[model samples]
Target: MIRTLDGKEEGFPSPLIQIRRQQSHLENWLENHKFPRIPCQSFVVISSPSTIIKAPKSLKSQILHSANIPYKLGVLEKKFKEQLLTKPTLKKLSKTLMEKHTEEDVDLFAKYNISKNDILTGVQCPGCGQFPAKRTQGFWRCSFCKHKAKDAHLRTLEEYKYLFGNKISNQQLRSFLHISSRTSATKFFSTLNYVHEGRTKDRVYFIP
Candidate 1:
């Protein structure tokens, strides 16, 4: 089951192709594990009822609208009853699949040679989705919509954490957030309740 957003149809993969690829991968994994090559099915459920799908007739059954899911699921349940594995067999397969897997972290910023200046920084407007919402009177106000938000900087900090790591100093926070005051940044970090190390200017906080 996959849920897709409205207005993002271009980003979505063809359900038929994704289903075939997934089924092929699953079959290969089952074969490698000396397990039965069980049949696999895929469903792409769009949340918007008005969203149109230009799928071929063969793929139409696999693409569902969110509103019709309950009835569709009820119909699919009757078909899959005979295909479910036994509880004991399922437990064995689960145990086998629980083996640890490790993947190396890839820094796309370094890999693509992206400079810090290339990234946009600032509290974004929740109202109009505009950047650099001005800090004024204990709130971040959007320049475009004049919308005010008290915790808009937190969202900006989240973006910073995703681009960089969770750890950030007061100076780094101010730089990334486009805040001028060091005292203001410290106060913001205090409100987050993150763990801190070192003292005074050397302090570094970790966002949880």
Candidate 2:
């Protein structure tokens, strides 16, 4: 019989199976997408430790800084151990953690809902829609209005890299894109390849 971390039959085929299903879904979503923010948001909501642990080293640090959460490899390991109980059960523990994180993400999003129409005139590019177009090997262009603008979404990714590298959090990107929503930022970033890291948020820009 399948048992929960508490060692009780929770009545599902198997908690491990459930965790595997959830993880597979998450992995597929991330693989199909380019920008990290959306997946990061989902990861946060799910409280997936893998999201935190497997994140690019650059992004992880940024996430910690953006969330104002303390970071120590040992701390994460301890938390994972306490929640997971055993190495063999790490998958289930990670799923549980992701679920909790997802809850927190929903709460945070509700708290800070910004309308994109207010910032970009509600007019998206026709060719690329909200996402910019690839202009060159490291440059992106906005099809709408035919503006030769760099990727605006990459700015947040760079910020995460600068602050936490792979540890960057969705919260940080949301806050950075004050004029837009988290979803918008994620879509926008997916179009760009690089960004200019800066000290001030306003100065950040997607560099193709």
Candidate 3:
């Protein structure tokens, strides 16, 4: 149920080209994605009364405007109700889709003009807010407050993943966490439950 908020719909076709593109994308994705057998339909919805939208003769019946939506969807609901899957199958299918939904290789550093220099280095003590929380003997030692938190590094890693990509490699974890040792980076990743892949140097981890 998507409706364009723009008031000027003067010259556009009923189910606009934009609407058709969306429909095509959904149809193609449904037919080609991992679960290609999932059933779905696309509709163009507009609610304005004065908007002169004229679908080509072939597609007029497919467009849904305010006046005919209830009757059309009511009829559709009765037909689709019988096709609902069992709970277990539906849940497993949803879980698979969610696990595979992570977008790969999105470089936020380039997208929003961010760089290593822009991020504030050092972990602030979770106990007492203070910068330059150095990694000392496998613990984040905040010199200002003399507070040590074993999990402070995890907070920084979480933030880095949030701002960048959901997936991370040893190199990315090292560079983002500002750790020099590969063993130290491995220690950080050990605490997370990730779908691991590849051999030693080429391994990547992503939450599923």
lDDT of each: 0.81, 0.43, 0.72
> Residue 185's C-alpha lDDT in candidate 2?
54
Q: Write the per-residue lDDT of candidate 1 for residues 1-208, one digit (tens) a residue.
A: 2336585433545666777787788788878988876766677788877777776798788888998888897987888778557888888888887762454577869989998779888888998999889888788898899899998877888888877888999999888877789998888777788999999879999977
- What TM-score would you give candidate 3 relative to the actual structure? 0.43
lDDT of 3 by residue, 138-178 (tens): 78887788899887876776776677656889988777666
User: Could you tell me every candidate's TM-score relative to the true structure?
Assistant: 0.67, 0.20, 0.43
lDDT for residue 157 in candidate 2, whole number 0-100: 50
> Which candidate leads in lDDT?
1
In model 2, which regions exceed 4 Å deviation? 1-84, 103-117, 122-208
Q: What's the distance in Å from true for residue 143, model 3?
A: 1.7
Inter-residue clash pairs, candidate 3:
none
Q: For model 1, which pairs clash?
A: none
How large an RMSD does model 2 have?
Answer: 20.1
lDDT, residue 13, candidate 2: 57
Candidate 3: stretches off by over 4 Å: 1-113
